[model samples]
Target: MSARVSDATSRLKSRRDDRRRHRIVGGLVAALIVVVLAAGVYVVAFSPVLSTRQIQVSGLKVLAKNDVVATSGIVLGTPLARVDITAAADRLAAVPAVADVTVVRSWPNAVSIAIVERRARLAIATDNGYLLADATGVVFQTVSDRPGGLVLVDAPTNDQQLLVDVGTVYSALSPDTAARVDRVVASTRDAIELRLKDGDRVIWGSAEQSGLKSQVLDNLLAKSGTVFDVSAPGFPTYR
Candidate 1:
């Protein structure tokens, strides 16, 4: 009876030891897995393997690629995950010629930049030369000579609203009529006018009803007149 009790106690102790061993082994494995995951995360987030190796610029025409890149403020060797895309894009958008910009991470080891440059629609005469203005009335650049395929704007002041009004009127004209326009003059927002290349003048009242005014002007040009007034398209006058 004593031997049997000892044997039973030994068996119970062995089972308890096995359970403890299993629990220890499981805890060690869990710790090892956690360490490996942390190491992997560190490698992906901070290691040089995922660092920015190249900057690819696209949709650039007027602005130099190098200049855009310089202004972007994106540094090589920066971790792709750490780059502030919005900040970079904002910096790029501040470029005078850039109308819109999109910055993104080309995964693995590269950054991609897409740019939409402003198109020069009009040239405002300035002391230095002609200041190029886009559709948004932003005078982005100046040139010593007049650029081709752009209308001239003659304003007493560089008023932003005047420029925008001129741009609106010019844009409203038909392609054929737009080509005939030599210069635009606007002393005030409501006193906008256009001078044709053939020495004809258009008395455009304001930016309002510009599309209707353009259509009326197109019809009136067929008549013999030096002065065409389409301030009110419903009551056009020519002489």
Candidate 2:
């Protein structure tokens, strides 16, 4: 009787395993059918029967619209589904001066690309060519064109902040005082000196108290004649 019970348990286990195998096979068949249907739909939707259409590009600065489209190797009437966005972005990024590139789908048969360009800060004159320096003072380009309106930076070689300090001092000056100013020079400790159009020197000590200084200069410039110096605020003395 005991042996008969053991045999019965083994048969039940075998039946359950068979049921699981059958279910798994049915699931695989269903997945295969779905995949086949999806592939068929894709072939119908984007097949050669569909005409390749226009490539749309936007947000481009450094790259010309045509160049971006051409780099994608995608021609008009080329199936949109065939264009690889990742590959297109990589190609556009290869173009010099293009800082960044983005590719996106525009549906049915259109593609869109976006490009960013490097920024130009100030261009200064050099012996042979004008050097273009970005905000961080790193020169990245040299060109033959005469770059204008950028003040030539002349400061002690040890001083690191002349360019930025002078620009700040100019910003703080009142219109009247600024108009009277001819050139601005940065000092060793970073206070800027503004050379007046009339050959007087205005010592703008540190950039800390500029609003006060502008008010004082506005009051003083009205009574100008052989002004000695206006360095420290309250004790401004002139001949």
Candidate 3:
């Protein structure tokens, strides 16, 4: 009887130990599953591996949306954090129409891009092609928008430097004269010259003669077709 009792007790102890081992193993597996699930949830919810779904762009009339999108380098697979703002702006500016650009991050995984475009200021006739000048006087490129009989000017050595001064002279003309006039040639330093619709020419004389020049131009239209030199304020010359 003692031997049978001892055997029964031993068997009970072994069964208890087996149950305990199973419980430990089950707990460990459960912990591993929880950890894996948490990691997966975190990756799905907040990871930058996900593509940026929202893109907001402003100041984009002359520029095309697809062109801007392509230049941004922020495609469907591009992560929000991986985007290089400077590189994107540089790339966009390379498109020629873009003057300046600003890139900012939106909430979640969105990016916003703002662009400033260069407007066609003046048209010039080059030897091989046409020259396009912007409002700032910097020459862009030869474009097809050359209005008929529009006067083309000679590009100076420093095109950018000439743009501000010449643009000022171009803007200072009267509304009617400005509309009728086509090209202002930077023929010399002391003065700027304008080519009009007819055979008439207005000698600008000097940039200082802007207001006077505008008045002379307005008066010239009233008179017959002739060369009006507005270099002098009070005493204007006409041919």
Query: Which candidate number maximizes TM-score?
Result: 1
Runs of candidate 3 with Cα error greater than 4 angstroms are: 1-46, 49-51, 54-96, 99-102, 144-151, 156-160, 209-212, 219-225
Per-residue lDDT of model 1, residues 1-239, tens digit only = 99999999999999999999999999999999999999888777899989999999999888898998889998999888888889999999898899999999999999999999999988999888898988656778889999988888998545887888888888899989988999998889999999999999999989999989999999999999999999989999999
* Candidate 2 wrong stretches, greater than 4 Å: 1-152, 157-159, 226-228
Best of the candidates, lDDT: 1
Candidate achieving higher TM-score, 1 or 3: 1
Please state every model's RMSD to the true fold in angstroms.
3.2, 8.5, 10.2
Mind giving the per-residue lDDT tens digits that candidate 3 earns over 7-109?
9999999999999999999999999999999886665455765447877889977678887988888775456666677888778878767778888767567
> What is the C-alpha local distance difference test score of candidate 3?
0.72
True-structure Cα RMSD, model 2 = 8.5
lDDT, residue 96, model 2:
49
lDDT score at residue 232, model 1, on the 0-100 scale:
85
Using lDDT, rank the candidates from best to worst: 1, 3, 2
Runs with alpha carbons beyond 4 Å of true place in candidate 1: 1-33
Alpha-carbon shift of residue 194 in model 3 (angstroms): 1.1
Q: Which candidate, 1 or 3, would have the higher lDDT against the true structure? A: 1
Report lDDT (CA) for all predictions: 0.90, 0.64, 0.72
Which lDDT tens digits does candidate 2 get at residues 1-239? 99999999999999999999999999999999999999876774667654357677777654577767788777777666677789888887776456667887677667777777655444445566665544333444567874554434334433435544544556667766666765555645445676677888777676656677777777776675655345676766555
